[model samples]
Target: MAKAFASQGDMADKKISFTEVGRDLWAFTAEGDPNTGVIIGDDSVMIVDAQATPRLANMVVEKVRSVTDKPIKHVVLTHYHAVRVLGASAYAASEIIMSDKARAMVVERGQEDWDSEFERFPRLFQGHESIPGLTWPTQTFAGRMTVYLGTRRVDLMHLGRAHTAGDIVAHVPDANVMFTGDIVEYHSACYCGDGHFGDWGGTLNAIKAFDVDAIAPGRGDALVGKALVGEAIENTRDFVDSTYRPAKRIAARGGSLKETWDAVRADCDPKFASYAIYEHCLPFNVARAYDEARGIDTPRIWTAERDKAMWNALQA
Candidate 1:
């Protein structure tokens, strides 16, 4: 699951696992592959982050049916990313929900981002034809929105921006669990190409404010305790810090971008080398680091053309 514009497909490098982290809360994760969160309540189900296509989403739907026949009431997107939000139409939920910022990203650069991601990773979008175009949320919120599947309450909040300007988390107080989108990637690579570094750090800090007993990150296993939660946050922060420090150092000294990338790679690859999507993510990660190193805080919007050129330059 290299974050760079690599072949988009299901990550077949490792085994996939779906774990129930709390009561009626499940993390549909496959190593570093895209993960879908499930919330089953008294009356219906709520899916967090649809996979790449309806076909992929159905794989999750199939799994959901295996355990319960509850109707899926809503699809909550922590933020908008082609891989994260595209399969939303498959749920047939009453409404697709997203933060106002997430919606704006979709509106602002959805198509371009879609093209860029599709070109980068084709496997993730295996059933490309099954995707019903860009996934648009019927219900949008600014800060936070509380929805209930019968009496069970699920809180969606955009604590701050990190991975993207619209990143959010789904917290179920009763369950004592939280599903963080790309805001927390667990042991997987953190795709920061379209990210705001400072804001992303803040987002992680905000997530810690919740009294979560279990945590489901964007990818990887669902952590069971606060120690694991602490590990997730610390590892993510270290990755980000290691990436940014070199980018900043190189950019300030007016050093070569590739050199900066190599330096960061030497550092991060050693620690996260065996982590999910390391190969797929490094190119884009380096590019983003280079940009941030030069004080480019807000990640530049990625386009299909840009995707190709960047990959050729790095991987070539």
Candidate 2:
């Protein structure tokens, strides 16, 4: 029989972990599911990356309440993926911020992404009915912005494009801990369906320049030491490179997408087969890598119909 589509077979609940990566900074991780970063300041809290729905976001709220009573005042979205921003309503944050390019992506392809991802991974969108609508940022910045919660300073910057065109990172200077969204994943697969393969390395290098003490990565365990932080970054870079290199070589010879898929699998499977979401991400990553190698600058938008068509084609 054909394999289950996308994450349709992944129904088991992930064990949740709320870890302190810095003095007052926490990482809300659910196994290899999407992770959220919490930065508590003197007066309020800042949430980096809202969960997929109100119910999931509320879980983060419960964790927050365990520590302090500070109201969640800001929701900083690293990118415009549905899993990252659709849960903004639950926070009721006064300000929801994203990079200018990200906000434009919301206007351009947000609905399609919501539809596509909802179909791709139903587990993440539990309590989907509670989602108000596409989450829009209350404010948008061009390159960087500094947000203050009383005395604490959180710097948000759009270093470059990696996972998506509008990726950003939140750096808490007080603790020297950075919250890197899908731009950096510890052991989990990097979803590169909408990624920029050519510029991803430079973006990773830009992040390396920070030399942060710790990091709450997009997925997987919270990185709490310089050693682990470096490992995750370099591993992420290797994952991206390993996936793209073989696909690029295949595409250069005018190979079919299916052929490129097989090539990428041969190159990546031994190293990353056990990574979270590795199977779900393979087809899309190969598709995007194939496109990038063919000189496609911007990633093609993925709609639900296109998602099925691509998956079926690869499986065939």
For model 2, residues 139-159, the per-residue Cα lDDT tens digits are 999999999999999999999
Number of backbone collisions per candidate:
15, 0
TM-score of 1: 0.94
lDDT of 1 by residue, 1-316 (tens): 3333475544465466778999888888876788899999999999999988887888888888888998998999988999999998897745899999889889899999898888776777778887768889999999889998899999999898788889889999898899999888787888888877766777788888785898889888888899999889878888788777777778788888788878888788778888777767777788987887677867788898887777777766
TM-score of each: 0.94, 0.99
Candidate 2, residue 123: Cα displacement in angstroms equals: 1.2
lDDT against the true structure, per candidate, is: 0.84, 0.94
Clashing pairs in 2: none
Q: Local error of candidate 2 at 111, Å?
A: 0.3
lDDT of 1: 0.84
Off by over 4 Å in 2: none
